[model samples]
Target: MIAAAWLFGVGGAILVGIGGFFRLARPALLPEDLRYLRRTPDEIDAAVPSLRGWLRLVFIVLGGYAVATGTLTIYLAATDIRNAESSAVAVLAVTGASSIGVMALVNFALHSTFRWPLSAAAALWIVATLMAVVS
Candidate 1:
């Protein structure tokens, strides 16, 4: 559980940093004088119609969920399970690390292409966590 918590926390932090960079900081940090060099007419047109406000809202929501998921794992580490012995902890560590790896891969892939699958990865994480809790 500790291992899972750590992996999830580190992964979530990286994701939050990425989301902040793209959704919150990048536009404001870009030089006003050099902005023209950053966009073609088509790019500018595409950007202009984008609902960035909505996108940022989504990022924030996902960020919150990531934080919660990571934190819950930390919380789990503090408790003993019903009928579980020392081996359960080791099993949890392996599962947690594996899940975090999967989550990271999904995130990396989504950054370049389809994003709907991110939700699927998140859903899997939630289901796996629930299984851990109940088992």
Candidate 2:
């Protein structure tokens, strides 16, 4: 069960980290045809300039940190299978659920960043994994 939690969280973190790196690498990959949140390449280029050199490096660094932390947490969870059914799991579940809600908010309000929705769903998966671990 704890292994499942770690899998979900770590997988999500890796995917998100990759997504962030992709944004930094090729911001052009972002969707530009959504009606609700119509974004264009021009807008992206204007907003982020695609290649910001040092800024890109910074984003990559931060994203790497997030990935590392998430992976470590997952590892810890896996090692805690004996006592997985604890309050910590419950807290993670709640956090994951809220993260989903926050992702929804970001999607609707920001209307950009395709990764937000994926992250939201991933959060739910992590929460579900936590529940399984607790059980």
Candidate 3:
């Protein structure tokens, strides 16, 4: 159970960290499947600056929050796996569920492509939360 929790927690952390990094430092890293990135090269180049510039601060803030939460889950799980504290499990579950909800909302609102990774991470975190609780 501890091993499973650790694996899921670390996997979630890595995914969230990578997402946060891309959002903060490399908006151009947006997946090609994203609706906003489906334009021609010239159009994409012309639009990337304005679009990314406009959302830069927002992305940075949200990304930072996501990274922080993900890191917190990893740290907490690593430090106290034996007890499987309820508070820690609650936080992990809440954050995981919140991430899924927020990502779904964002995808609906902006018609973006952030759902896939968010869904994946959310699933892992949810499983980790369950494992922690059971253990």
Which has the greatest lDDT? 3
lDDT of 2 by residue, 1-135 (tens): 645565556544654565466445643243532344465556646876744465466667766654554564455455553366565565555544444445456656656566575565665566656556657
Candidate 3's TM-score: 0.66
- Give the per-residue lDDT digits (tens) of candidate 1, residues 32-127: 312434665456547665644565566666556545545554444444423343454455455445545465565455452324444444544455
TM-scores of the candidates are 0.41, 0.52, 0.66
Which ranges in model 3 have alpha carbons more than 4 Å from their true place?
A: 28-51, 108-112
Each prediction's RMSD over C-alphas, in Å, is 9.1, 5.0, 4.1
Best-first order by TM-score: 3, 2, 1
- The alpha-carbon lDDT assigned to residue 132 of candidate 1 equals 46
Candidate lDDT (C-alpha), each: 0.47, 0.54, 0.64
Candidate 3, position 68, lDDT: 73
* C-alpha lDDT (0 to 100) for residue 74 of candidate 3: 73
Worst 10-residue lDDT window for candidate 3 reads: 28-37
Candidate 1: pairs in clash: none
Candidate 3 lDDT by residue in tens digits, 1-135: 677568656755764675578565756435543555557656755766566556676677777777776677677677655466677677667766676546655665665566676556566666777777777
User: How high is the lDDT of residue 84 in model 3?
Assistant: 60
Candidate 2: segments with Cα more than 4 A from true spot? 2-51, 94-104, 113-120, 126-130
- Using TM-score as the measure, the top candidate is 3
Clashes of each: 0, 0, 0
